[model samples]
Target: MSLFYLLAVILIASAIFTITQKSPVYSVVGLLVNFLALAALYFTLNAEFLGVIQIVIYSGAILMLFVFVIALLSSGVGPFRAGPNRLPRIAAPALLTTLVAFGFLIFGIAQRPFGPLPPHRPTSFLGNVGDPNVFGSVGDFGVALFTVQLLPFEVTAFILMVAVIGVVLIAGDAVPQPTLGRHRPQKRAAEREPILKAPAP
Candidate 1:
């Protein structure tokens, strides 16, 4: 077997293990390993820029979010149970979606045309030597964001900001007030005696 195929097999196994793991923390670790393997695969494909993005976005940002969510929602033993029918309800839709996606993928792959790709002059050298904005450079990205796709870029940023704010608001503690200890008995207002009473006629 080729080295790439072997790596691909390991990657698929790791991904499946990550999904099926009972422990959220362990799943996150497995996902991290999967991301690293995917980055290695991207490198093998000679897509250095995409590999860096996989590390930065998937391995760094998304994994951190997952870890934070797991920590917030669970206490290591396990998370709280949902309604009895939740699994079946969720599972049906998920299975349908998966089948649909697989069908589309098979159809597309079968219909894809195979031909020699057109050759192009390398842009990397000119970008490195002539242009100040090189390929995959921050400056080039910024220019593209503001010049070509300014509105969409701003909209995406706004959506992300809203998402962050919503998460913070949902996770924020309610206004804390003084509280008696958990075991302490609560005093009833009626328990206190009236200060004054009318005299008997």
Candidate 2:
């Protein structure tokens, strides 16, 4: 559909924007746009619960956390320094792995007969779009999340927690500077050099 194509374009453009920005703030803004567009795509697919979760959890919570981290890092004494690059060391292996994955994907697709996709509406499991009781409804999603998919749900939550913890640990005290409510004494004016010493006459 035209709507799907439009959303797909937006998704791809925003994704590219997110990665190509020089400023992290701009990148985050682009990422937020990408998330919103993804949620819209989910809505088009009738996955309302997923759309809402994508917006609420990823856009609301995770994005805000990233912004807070960026702000905290910016509050330090100087611009944050980056670690050594290992891209050169891993580039060849990464390219080989990608090619192997693509080969598998192509082989798998070749095995399946191409045919028209089934109609989207009035499915056996999901039911009609207007139905009060449907697979993608909040109640159903909750039930499934808590029952058959409980392990995956818990594992995802655990991974998110670990990611948050890792961010906190890595962002901690990379520079020796005062944090909230903690101040270091400044050097005396006499002990410090002048910003511009008077030129010798």
TM-score of each: 0.60, 0.64
Which predicted model would earn the best TM-score? 2
Error of 2 at 111 (Å): 2.7
Clashing residue pairs in candidate 2, if any?
none
The local lDDT score (0 to 100) that residue 138 gets in candidate 1 is 49
Cα shift from native, residue 109, model 2 (Å): 3.1
Clashing pairs in 1: none
lDDT of 2 by residue, 58-159 (tens): 999999999988987878735567679887899899889989999999999999888775665423243332343364767766766677678988999999
What digit string (tens of lDDT, one per residue) describes model 1 on residues 141-193? 55655776688879999999999999888766554546676656766889967
Best by lDDT: 2
Off by over 4 Å in 2: 77-81, 85-96, 122-133, 154-201
